[model samples]
Target: MRYLVDLGWLRSGLSFSFGEYFDPENTAFGVMRVCNDDLVAGGKGFGPHPHSDMEIVTVVLRGQVKHEDNLGNAEVTKEGQVQRMSAGSGIIHAEYNASESEELQFLQLWFMPRARGGAPSYETSSYEPSQMVNHLLPVVSHTGSEQVASINQDLTIYLSRLERGNELSFHQEAGRRVFLFVIEGELEVSGHVMETRDTARIQNEPHLQLAAKEDTKYMLIDLP
Candidate 1:
């Protein structure tokens, strides 16, 4: 019912002093695709690039990033903020550090478009850290449910922060997959211990069980 992907086994790419860890061909997990954890150095970032037919979401874990796009959306995304962009027909955007003294740590995720081609759009939202403590805070979801960032796929992403002795529960759908990424601290998911940067890919289970071995921060992605 569950499979694990150690962060060590994933490929890492370094560009502009940034580290990008990802899986491409191995990305398919029931409509949800691409999960990338990226850390960028202070003062350096991704140049404007074009993409089409993909839904991209960026979750900032620490520090700040300045974002500029063809949709005329420009702002600095700080810790606790989520940025959602739909590269429908085509769009160009650039993400860079907003400060020269701090590094930017975040996750860049991509989902295959439900259908092909449309007008591009962007949105950003700030979620409180206290809101995610010991619980799953929905960051992005299909249909823009509950005021969260909208995506093109039937998937939902929740960020969780748990302290030692804390645990979180998630009921599973019959034919979906759940991917858990430990962004900080240590956790035991269904008896399997995972440290920072570790990940778990799960499917077919009736529910997910997780307990913090210590203070922990993580993300749970539920996809159809």
Candidate 2:
């Protein structure tokens, strides 16, 4: 199931119990606590906020994001960049649009860490747009073995940009969960047709298939 969240300058298609849209049965999926397709207004951004014991990931979809944290990392994440923040014990951070004239669009994901209470950390990585074309590129992973940023969780984040008619497949393990979030265009996952801002949650399934109905860009979360 999916939920639409349009908050004027800050819109999101939330995948879990987020903000005021709460659902006890839809609180979380596996280790994934939050999945939000966010679009922020230019010259406006989130103020400094505290977080603890959470692995946060920011996937830049368009424009750019500037991040400042108490850990002394003031970084800008551009389009196609992934920013990973591990608020082990605690961290205070602020996010804003890197460009005052352009809006910022991104996907912000939060996951429960395997263990908590350690020092906070931050890192970032980027990929070429063509790198994800027609294939799933591992942008974030737990083992630090993938060709992307490392995070403190047992999950993998895959990104793809498929042209119309392109096809792909994903295999899931028992008790694992998978989530599909469409960033642009359209795609068909199994028998479900998903458009922009739509998300599909999968579990207890063995095989997952995806086909591009139109030129589509999307994100997939493989969580335990």
lDDT of each: 0.79, 0.89
Query: Model 2, 38-102: lDDT tens per residue?
Result: 88989778999999999999999889999999989999998878999999999999999888889
**In model 2, where do residues sit more than 4 Å from their true spots?**
1-8, 145-147
**Cα TM-score of candidate 2:** 0.94
Candidate 1 local distance difference test against the native: 0.79
Q: What are the per-residue Cα lDDT tens digits for candidate 1 across 49-126? A: 998898888898888989999889999988888998989999999989787877777787777778879789888877
Q: Which candidate is the best by lDDT?
A: 2
Off by over 4 Å in 1: 1-25, 145-147
Each model's total of backbone clashes: 0, 0
